[model samples]
Target: MMARDPIRLWLNAHLGLVYVFLYVPILVLIALSFNKSGLPTAWTGFSTEWYGKLVANPKILSAAGNSLIVAVASTIISTVIGTLLAMGLEEGRSNPWLDALVAAPMIIPDIVLAIALLSFYTLLNMSLGLHSIVLSHAVFNIAFVCMVVRTRLKNFDRSIVEASIDLGASELTTFRRVTLPVIAPGVVAAALLSFTLSIDEFIIAYFTAGAGQGSTTFPMQIYAMIRFGVTPEINAIATIVIGFSFFLVLLSQRLNREAAP
Candidate 1:
């Protein structure tokens, strides 16, 4: 083999360090999930007891169901609206101000957005619950989805759209048959991203979920558990969540790669 260049060797070394920094903690946490001792510091052999306990816990089940509701609702709504918005904006005039406005939610602080949503809902006299959480999640989720779809749209061939229109296709038919097919991968990726964010979000969900056990989400439950102190059960829950998020992100990347021209 050719001798590695010093610069290339250095870059590889740096990349290795970065990966270790990012993933070592996550690996430790996953490993600890199998620990029978329930303590973070000591590894007292492997066990699946915590996973069983998680199933038996009614509160965790309820919270997980609530999170699923919010994530799915937000993902569906955000994917539709964001995909349409991205296509419209891309096909229309390219205005920086308008683009910034669409992206504001992604740039804004989560706490600020949560407070604003809470105040807006309170002003409208809307009841805060799972539905409220879904709406709140959709707000940011829409922006995230729009951003991803817009990136994919940047690489789209406008000629295809023109060809469809030239073929006497209606705007709806063109979008349904031509535009959507080209962008479907991006749309799916964005939807997965939205779902992941909705499930993992804590501060915004906490603010909008209102005051009921019925509205408690998985992240909210995790927060409460952490306040009590870490345990093997918490590790199991965290490992599951992290694994799920990682899987969705990886899938999104794969879809995006496949969509690339």
Candidate 2:
């Protein structure tokens, strides 16, 4: 029998502790969401009244709808532009500076990006609303989508595209029939990731959303609620957002794995 390595065991133990530190709070939040009492400090019993209240709140519903609209719009725009950008970069000679430029959005602080976006909107004399938020989110999400698509493209068979082109097919035709099919899984995965990011995004949305309740997103709504004080309702909203984001991540991984050779 082989003996276990002490170093490997130690690393595994440390990793487990790290995960517990990260996720234990999330688990506690989820539990508190179901608590009968409104306060996190006092857990009277398990009840879903908080979630019920969330459903009954009209403002919550409106905010959620705005979030959905922004997420869908931004995801669509980002995925489309990012996919094309990834393909263009993959086909060309790589430049380190260009790569850095492409990755800037994902690397920059969210607040920095938020302030930059707000300034750009002001320069353009654009009115702040859900549409502005959608554009801002698309800008933020483009880098993530491009990175994911570029990773998928690393394993792509380029000869297939060349062969299609040689067979008297136009670039558009070849893209639709050959390149698109090969990268569809990656594009879908990127879109799901983009949607999740847009849904949870608060800083940029808060800045670009301007002065209106009509453009308020779910995260902004949660922030407004928090200023009044944390309650079980906020916990419920957080729990749902976390669960949805987790599901999207899992699904993205599933698609990526299935695309693997």
The best candidate in terms of lDDT:
2
- Whole-model alpha-carbon lDDT for candidate 2: 0.93
- Lowest lDDT sum, 10 consecutive residues, model 1, at 1-10
Model 1, span 59-125: residue lDDT tens: 9999999999999999999999999899889889899999999999999999999999999999999
Q: In lDDT terms, how accurate is model 1?
A: 0.92
Clashing pairs in 2: none
Taking every candidate in turn, the Cα RMSD to the unseen true structure, in Å, is 2.0, 1.5
Question: How many clashes would you count in candidate 1?
Answer: 0
Instruction: Report how far off residue 27 is in candidate 1 (Å).
Output: 0.8
Q: How close is candidate 2 to the true structure, as a TM-score?
A: 0.96
TM-score against truth, every candidate: 0.94, 0.96
